[model samples]
Target: MTLHPIESGNFKLDGGAMFGVVPKSLWTRTNPADANNMIDMAARCLLIEDGDRLILIDTGMGDKQSEKFFGYYYMWGDHSLDASLAKAGFHRDDITDVFLTHLHFDHCGGCIINNPNGNGYLPAFKNAKFWTNENHWNWAVNPNAREKASFLKENILPMQDSGQLNFIKKTTKDSFQTSSELDFGIFFADGHTEKQMIPRIDYKGKTLVFAADLLPTAGHIPLPYVMGYDTRPLLTLDEKAQFLNEAADHNHYIFLEHDAHNEIITVQHTDKGVRLKDTYTFNQLFK
Candidate 1:
């Protein structure tokens, strides 16, 4: 099996919102903010090739929103989903499965695109089955007031409309094996968004986890660095504490999604609890 880190694009977000209640004095040290207080973030996704299946985890924000809509996020960078796929020797049609961590625009917007013929939106990955859990599918479609803005309809509804949407069965267990032969497992987290599925794959004698919004960056390794956007901040604290302890103990490499500078990181159980042990580029891990 081969894993590739796909660089979709970069955007800026308010540092305060990214690191909830955590004082700027602390988080700014790791993710320094610009003069406008917006920090650089990457819409980094992951692509996995195991035999006949080419599975993509998260799609990143697509270039479909109006300029006014995108201005709020401060989208930047030259990277794109199509170019990243080409670099990996693949195309949109090659993806057999799209495992969305959640339906947030930044994470799944690339799933759909405006038709070139001036028609309505269509699935970007025309032949792939879009995978999202039943709980999250419901949560996203009928988004609550707090999260409504993040779950854009154009980025989501088209998949179901195109008859390519498939729901992963809800599992009560912490981890459940996926239908794919890649031996992938889904770990569900509720603090960030209801039933956000974090993919855990056993690759090359090591466990690599797609650390979605649950752990957006290495700076979020601390238990208290929860996002202000989360509906339940207290629940996030508990979830982070439990997940970090296990990840540190098992030496799992976390694939960060929003961290612009750091792609992957491992944690160690320090006196201050779980702290980052080492950082690496995706290629560095294989070497």
Candidate 2:
């Protein structure tokens, strides 16, 4: 099995929003903000090439929103979902499975796109089965007031409408095991969003975790650095503490979805608590 880092693109978001209650003086060092207090973020997704299946985890924000809508977040960068796939000698049609960590626009927007001739939304990966948990699917579709904005209908409804959506059955087991070469086990965390599935993949004997929004960047390594967008902030603290302990214990590498500067981070149990030990690009591990 071969794993490829597919960079969808880069966009800017309010540092305060990204870092939550964390102070500017603190998070700014790791993610320097612009005059608008917005920090650049990467919509980095992962692609796994196994024998017959090419699985893509999280599709970056697609270029379908209106100008006014896009004005809120400034997007910059040459990377694109299609372009990155082409670079990997593949196309959208080549994908067989799209495993979505969650339904947030930045994470799954690229899964659906405007159809040709402007009919309506269509599946971005025409040949892939979109995978999302039943709980997350229900939570996103029937979103609460706090999360309504992040769960954009344009980025979600099309999947179910296209008849390509499938739910990963919730198993009673502690860890979800996959027979595929990805060697990923889905771990559900409710703090960030309801039933947010973090893919823990064992690649080349090293456990690599797709941190999603649970741990967006290295700046979020501190136990208290929780996102403002999380539904249950206190639960996030508990979840992070537990997850970090496990990651550190197992020497797992965290794949950050939004950190424009650092793609992957390893944690260490420090005197102050859990802290980032090393930061590197995703490919660094494979190398």
Candidate 3:
């Protein structure tokens, strides 16, 4: 199996929102914010080439949204989904699966695009079977006031409408069916979003987990540093603590989705709590 780092691009988000109650002085050390207090975030997705299946983890923020809508995020970078795929010697048609961690615009927006003549939204990956959990789908479609803004309909409805949506109907603890030559597992996390699915893959005798929003960046390794965007901050704290312990115990490498600088990181159990031990890019781990 081969893994490709598909960098869609970088965007800025309020540092305070990203770090929650954590003071600026603390998070700024790792993810320094701009004059606007927004930190650089990467819509870093992963592409797994396993035999006949080429699975894409998540689509970055697509370019279909209106300028006004995108102005808020302040996306800045040359990387694009199409360009990244082209670099990997593939196209949208080559993707057999679109495994969405959740329906947040940044995570799934690139899954849909404007129709040829700008008629309506359409599936970006016409041939790929979009994968999302049933619970998360419902939560996103009928979003509560807290998360309504993040779950954009343009990024989601098209999948089901295109007859390509499939639910990984199983417990959050259910592992990916990697037994028969496929080496991957699905871990469900609810702290960031309801039933956000994090993919765990066996690569080069090491376990690599797609950290999704569960652990957006290495800076979040500190226990109390939770994102203010999360619906239930306390749940996030509990989830992070439990997951960090497991990652540290097993020496797993976390594939960060939003960390612009650090793509992968490993945590160690320190006297205070689980803290980042080393940071590396995804390719470094595979090498």
Candidate 4:
């Protein structure tokens, strides 16, 4: 099995929003903010090539939203899904599966695109079966007030409407849900959303985790550095603590999706809990 770290795109999010109640003085050390208080973030997705199945985890924010809509989040960077895929020697059509960690716009927006002739939206990876759990699907379709903004309909409904949407049955095995469909185990964390699935893939003797919002960046290594967007901050505290401990103990490598600067990282149990031990580019370790 070969893994490709896909750089879908990059954007800026408010450092305060990204760091939650954590004061700027602390988070700034790792994730320095710009003049506007926006911190750099990357819509970094992962692509796994195993046999004939090319599985993509999380589609970054697509290029469909209106200028005004995208103005909210300061979009920057030259990287794109197509360009990244080409660099990795593949295309969207080659993807046989798309496992979404969650339904947030930045995470799943690239799932759909404006059809030819500039009309209605359609699935970007028409050949791939979109994956999301039943609980997350229901929660996203019927979103709460706090999460409605993040769960854009255009980025989501098209998957189900296209008849390509599929659910990953959560076969609870130990702490994670084992899915025979993909080569990874998913650990569901409700703190970030209804059921954000964090993929744990064993590749080349190292356990690589797709640290979605559960651990967005190295700056979020601290237990209290939860995102303001998280529906349940307190729940995040518990879930993150457990995950970090396990990652540190098992020497698992974390594939950060939103950290623009740090791509992959590993944490160690420090006096202050699990702290970022080292960081690596995808090629540095994966190669």
Q: Judging by lDDT against the true structure, name the best candidate.
A: 4
Off by over 4 Å in 2: 173-183
Candidate 2 local Cα displacement, residue 173, angstroms: 6.5
Error of 1 at 59 (Å): 0.5
lDDT of 4 by residue, 113-200 (tens): 9988877889999899999989899999999999999999999999989999999887774558778777678999989898899999
Candidate number with the higher TM-score (1 or 2): 1
Clashing pairs in 4: none
Model 1 per-residue lDDT tens digits across residues 127-157 = 9999998889999999999999999998989
**Candidates' TM-scores?**
0.96, 0.96, 0.95, 0.98
Predicted structure 1: lDDT? 0.90
Instruction: Single out the weakest 10-residue window by summed lDDT for candidate 1.
Output: 174-183
Weakest ten-residue segment in model 3 by summed lDDT:
174-183
Candidate lDDT scores, in order, read 0.90, 0.87, 0.88, 0.93
Candidate 2 per-residue lDDT, tens place, 42-141, comes to: 9999999988989999999888888988789898979999999999899999999999999999999899889888988889889989999888999999
Ranking by lDDT: 4, 1, 3, 2
- In candidate 4, which residue ranges exceed 4 Å CA deviation? none
Error of 1 at 12 (Å): 0.5
